[model samples]
Target: MGGAMKIVLIDSNARAVSSEDREVSVGSLTRLLGSKPAVTARLPNGDRLLTAKEPCVDNGFTIGRSRVVVGAGVVVGKRDAVGAYTPPKTNVDTLTKLVRWVAPDNMPRESEDGRTMVTAILVDPETRDIRQVSLRSDAGSLDGAVGGRCRFMMRVTTADAVFVKVGIGPRAAWRKDGLVFPGRSLIVGCSRYGTLVDVATDIASLRASVEFKSPDAPDWLPPSR
Candidate 1:
């Protein structure tokens, strides 16, 4: 069974203009709000705060003591939908589980006493989830491949890594590898010795790139193109 649903149209000052009980559905809410609604917040009590997906300053309203500007915002309960309440679809935080690395068979080998290190930056094209992973090879072996996972699924459009170090101690040095895999989707594999490999995938692609930032350079210096 579905829970009772309520819709309230508020102004920029957070005052409710009209409040009523209604069956929750995208179409019904869109028609009432005069625009597509976006879930802005998930309340502690399982209620959701929804507002126009795009800014609607003309019909803006403020809510709470914080005065959040929720233009045409609507509040609904968890089970307010026609059937069961289904949360809004979001790429953010989706598939956030750890992804294992697909190491190459011919990964570079290091000396028995030496250690290999690699730093990889991975981004999900769809969610724009950026993650940094550090991998270290066991002493004397080239099998230091680690997986990558997103700590925070941000809406960042771009990411850059300057001064990437790959290799064993003393032998570890910076490399200039700027690569972008746009449009095409691919999985990433990193060798213990800091080599990056790409495998094409059908659904989504990852972007990998590296730039050298001199140790002596000032912190404020922008990365070289």
Candidate 2:
């Protein structure tokens, strides 16, 4: 990848510190955490699961020097990491809200009206999740953007596939008329976890960018390096 990729950090609010970096490769995430995420708990069914709730903060991702420590609730993987992490309950609800807003209320929508089309990032009242926005499929000659907007949920552990209940959602602001007195932007603002605040740059293809060598990466999409 060249100097074409960029990253942005957000706090608890919709405020953001965007990136000017040229390229953010698929093998982009490099952990700066204290250790690999490890948590052990037995399920009520007598099963077990490991938990990594830590968030990606600062160079927690090697995108650049700038990093924000949202929390370590997310798992920290190896150098070439690939796994899924579900959004917190809050984000789950937020996602539900965004999906519901669309007329039919599906998901994985595209941006037809204009800016709200591609979801660069999803923002809650405070903090933002990179993968939590609508994706524009046609923009980069990519897949994933199937509906009017792209939405991914289910929060699988990073594997070969970025799995979710993907579908198209309605771009709420448009209706054969001009702009809705209150125009919408890419950064969606929300109140809780499942909600979203649209950002200016939603790189949907990255959702498909998995570590090239990781067997966990989705086989259909291009591998991330």
Candidate 3:
């Protein structure tokens, strides 16, 4: 299942290959992931279901959890409509500390279905300045790729090196225009090498160009267009 999430890559012949795990037909995977219902089903005991629900965030990753209690219905599998879900955790101390310090205070407050958004906060430990960097799902909606290709455009790079903690949350809603929600979660740490002197102020714009900050190796993003 994890392999399904690896970014697809092309070989010298331009043929797509799976880098991490089992290879799946790109077309099929795309259809399965793309057309998820606003609500989905989960199988319980003896193909009987006792609940129904939608996806939400725990920690900082997407998860399907129960919203309705039906007592009993049709059991499909052992996986509950509300299964055990947790954000993928990282062991980096710096990131852990920073996220602990900042996330609760700055998590996004909007809620909507089918929305995936990232909010970046850059802190200059040396300078102790905090800048709120946010990107809305609307700003970088994924679309239009051949053969189940997933894509989006956003600007997220800094001119100077900096340590950035990015947190992504899922918004839950019952209607097109309802109260904003805060439940789903996804978090990633980015360290930009060189000098990301202006990263904080330009995060949103950077994401708009699909450019993001990285600290470990050479920048792996496309040049500004």
Candidate 4:
């Protein structure tokens, strides 16, 4: 791979941080983590399951550099000339509260007609966990803009499969219109490649990049070297 590939670190939240590099390769992971070692664990049924723990992180390129961990996973072998990691799954939900007026009941609601979308970043909020990113917005107007037509526009992001679940609720009757109902909700699970799960949405295919870290890396691996 070229020098373009950089390392990525994904916190427990699943949000990803792409190391400032390009052309990340798969074989590099095995070298950094040392090959996977076979481990044995007894199951509750008195049976043993053999498993392999792949390395997902590596030391910094040189001494005194920041450590680098692949946000996603490493790209191992190629299938049909395409390098791919274990694809992450995405799940998300969107809720909309429709009100005839702007007040405590409605709270300055945007036009009921715009598209509602969402964007998210995966991050483990626990402080004990090394991964944490501050998501400023708790509850407020989404930054996205709506089209001239009154359609609502919503966007969200997440780590696993990016899934979009539209709002679902009862309808409301407006002045003269009689019964005006909310739009149908949508659940989209897109591959890294941009392919939506059920809906016919264009998504770029996901390419493999990183993997897990070696079990001993926490201790034996230098902080940045």
For each candidate in turn, the TM-score is 0.30, 0.17, 0.19, 0.17
Which lDDT tens digits does candidate 3 get at residues 58-149?
A: 21211122221111111122323555221222222322222211112222334365333344443222222234444442212111101122
> Model-by-model lDDT, in order?
0.37, 0.26, 0.25, 0.23
RMSD of 4: 25.0
Candidate closer to the true structure by lDDT (higher is better), 2 or 3: 2
Question: What does candidate 1's lDDT look like per residue over 1-225, in tens digits?
Answer: 233454544433333344566656777777656678777766555666677676544433223311233355665556544555634322212211211222234232333544333344433332334455443322211122212211221212222212221322332112223343331111233322223322222112222232223334433222232
Model 2 C-alpha lDDT per residue in residues 103-170, reported as the tens digit of each score: 11212233565322324432211111224545542322113332223333222222111212222343
Best by lDDT: 1
Report backbone clashes per prediction.
Answer: 11, 64, 35, 58
Ranking by TM-score: 1, 3, 2, 4
Give the per-residue Cα lDDT of candidate 4 at 131: 20
Q: What ranges in model 3 sit over 4 Å off? A: 1-59, 62-102, 114-199, 202-225
Model 1: ten consecutive residues of lowest lDDT: 91-100
The TM-score that candidate 2 achieves is 0.17
Our model 1 lands, by Cα RMSD against the true structure, at 18.2
- The deviation in Å at residue 73 for candidate 2 is 37
What's the distance in Å from true for residue 213, model 4?
Answer: 51
